[model samples]
Target: MSYVWTLGEQFEGKLRGVSFELLARGKKLAEELDTKVCSLILGHNISDEDLEELIQRGADEVYFVDDPRLADFQNETYSNVISDLINQYHPHIVLAAATTIGRVVMPYVAIKVNTGLTADCTQLEIQPETKLLLQTRPAIGGNIMATIKTPDHMPQMATVRPKSSRPLDKDPSRSGKIQRIVLKDELVDTRAKVIEFRTDDAGFVNIEEADVVVAGGKGLKQAANVKLVEDLAKQLDGVVGASRQAIDRGWLSYPHQVGLSGKTISATLLLTAGISGSIQYLAGIKTCENIVAINNDPEANIFGVSDFGIVGDLFEVLPLLTQKLAQAKK
Candidate 1:
């Protein structure tokens, strides 16, 4: 009866970007199954302002659980609370954002609830014949795609990677119902404790939400030349990305790095500079709508998969292309 989506905490009571995307996708799946889209917002002392907005976005019902002591994140407490909510709703499907919190909590909840959980799913569909949730994920080191289903489970559970699915277009006029669920404060507190936290200036851009991405790889000779990649991305009004090698060398932020060891993105226009397009890198970005690759090597592996291929040194080509685009804009 319920397609429940979990919304994680951000700055204060704010919703993370990926949480909205999950709600939009959950709305679609709910509509397909003729069920209501219910969102479970978890955090300590979340404002009604936040809960009300989630209902407006797409959720048919909002379940808010709040406590002042629960402000800081401790995996055990949060997961236990969410699991309790699932038990009450008995939802048919449960979706979580494949974020650091969701990733840790989902696996734990799945094992506790005795259900199968799919992590980093790029695609999801309800099978017409069986009504089984067909969850798709990158398999075999991102070389192949695998679709999995838990036939005997009541509420199908899965965590989807951020930016893989776009959020529903905001409709301020949209209306829905909000239902605050009972929280077992005693149980949740006893289950977990928060000692301290560490914050890193990972980045400002939610690269997953970017419509276009320009990424650089190992071919760009030196760390100083990484600026070329950023310039091109800026020209396109898109985010900049890098390959595993670039990140490993401390040339780019870990969040900006794309490959097996990093995040996955499905931007509309993915422009690659100097990247050789290794299978691992492609695994993260294969879902892009239009891919443009530039490499000096005519026989680069990137050419085999790129929709548009340009053979040239990225140092020479990137500046020219950025200038051309800038002039066109002017």
Candidate 2:
């Protein structure tokens, strides 16, 4: 048996942290299956040092596919190559991070391979007797968790939630076999090409990457009330976040949204104001070290998972909290 993780492209010149997290989970699953952990790195001009880093993380073998066509992630090209590799290797289990790349690539590959794939899986385990990959993920807007398995599939595939686990400590001394895949002539063909790339000039803060987040929701009442949440976040030296309601109301942009449809975050501290927690929202912040909730309603579901809860109007509470934080800085 073999456990394979499809590694994603670099973010800010380093491998996305999710890649390492998947490696950590892959290591555990490989042991359970009595198999070797392997990683697929698909991109252009991948370095030997990077391959070694992957091996050190957990992979016993690293497959590197370098081609100019892979420099920018085109879904067709990436999924096609990954599907072909999976077909060839016949690994027992394959995992990918549930990032934009993985979300797009894995589904396409799954269709090509005619296999079922579980997306945004929060937990993974192998059945002791059956040896099936037990995949668990939030279902029905996060109200329930569905454990799924691809019993008859050659390679059980899943996209793991980001920040669900930490990477193993890198050991520079660890070594593994590195195989370079020569792209076949047909594999290089792609239907789509990125003509131009545009970036957000507004300086958006990715809440998923923030250590501290102050998020507001519909309980904020209106767009103007959201300023209090923003001010509080600034005082706390954190990024601002919003529930789907806030984003739909145009008080926050899509990038600032956090929940099942939004980004999964593992912040050290998540302070939410005026948000009555929904299961979908809670799923995104499951890995937060500490959650602080403030709302006027005493029965707000956000308090259920919060380390601390304050039952008071956010309009009054936020200013006081911001003031106290500012005083502490003095």
Candidate 3:
């Protein structure tokens, strides 16, 4: 009846990184609140295979709904299951990853439950006075961090981007109970058909998975300079990401852009070359473990978040860094 946090488990045959990330956060939140943490897993007859790993992820209890309709991720079907589960159990706080599936389903679930959600949040805290969720996200790019809340909601919901939060040290010793939830006919519907599932090659080192990412902004000055960043990334064995400006300038594709309106990534190490680190750009990639900033402008905002900074022309610095890291590797 009284749980501090509920993790929305996203299963792709196995538990995802975001799911473990949420569990790690939930475990911390639950300890702070002196309450239990639970995870919601929905799939068709996956109770035996899926629920055990969730238990190992620091969950006090795993609430599972085994149904045929949940075989694939259908927005309506997924949202309905989540919405119904929330109404039935009524947990205090719900946290979902801002992954593509979560992006599609969380808002719908929140709207269905008539609750406000903080989208693409980077930080989360609890109000010490009232023990309420303080959801913080990037506003107007990555320039400003905004904390939000829903005053008139039962279970506060927040959707966090991947790698924003660190996962807990895995403990196979942590064990819990798995409760199978029975889904009735009302929860079953067919608005769509999933004929073929094609895995889109997420491409060279998914920026989200990269320990280090080298990103370029409009300051590259010309489309040709994007290759400089790419070459550097190749040397560093890191992925190449860009600001929306670079993509809009036709220097890069939308998939490579990192910003409020772009892909969200948090790497252990991130390098910003020629980028101004506008708030929107920061909104997407600010949670990096270590940031290296390179720009000619000494007043650039990237210096604020970067662990190390190089104030020099990128054209000079990139090739040198690339060559230096390359030589060191050999």
Query: Which predicted model would earn the best TM-score?
Result: 1
Poorest stretch of ten by lDDT in candidate 1: 2-11
Rank the models by lDDT, top first: 2, 1, 3
Instruction: Decide which is better by lDDT, 1 or 2.
Output: 2
What clash count goes with each model?
0, 0, 6
Q: After the best TM-score superposition of candidate 1, give how far the Cα of residue 261 lies from its true spot, in angstroms.
A: 2.0
Better of 2 and 3 by lDDT: 2
Best by lDDT: 2
lDDT scores of the candidates, listed in order: 0.80, 0.84, 0.79
Pairwise lDDT winner, candidates 1 and 3: 1
- Per-residue lDDT tens digits of candidate 2, residues 145-165? 899999987688999877667
Candidate 3 per-residue C-alpha lDDT over 3-47 given as tens digits, one digit per residue, 9 for 90 to 100? 754545545445567777888777777787788889877766454
Residue 152 miss distance in model 1 (angstroms)? 1.2
How are the candidates ranked when ordered by TM-score, highest leading? 1, 2, 3
Which digits, one per residue and each the tens of the lDDT, describe model 1 over residues 1-330?
A: 456565545546677777678888888888888888878776666667777677767888887776655566677777788778778768888888887777898898898788999988989988999877899997776677899998998678999877787777777787787776666765465655566765567454566657899999888878898899889988999988999988888887788888677767778899999899788887788777789999999998888879999999888899999999999999
Error of 3 at 93 (Å): 1.4
Residue ranges of candidate 3 with Cα displaced over 4 Å: 9-11, 44-51, 142-144, 194-210, 219-227, 234-237, 297-301
TM-score of model 1 vs. true structure: 0.89
Off by over 4 Å in 1: 6-11, 45-49, 189-209
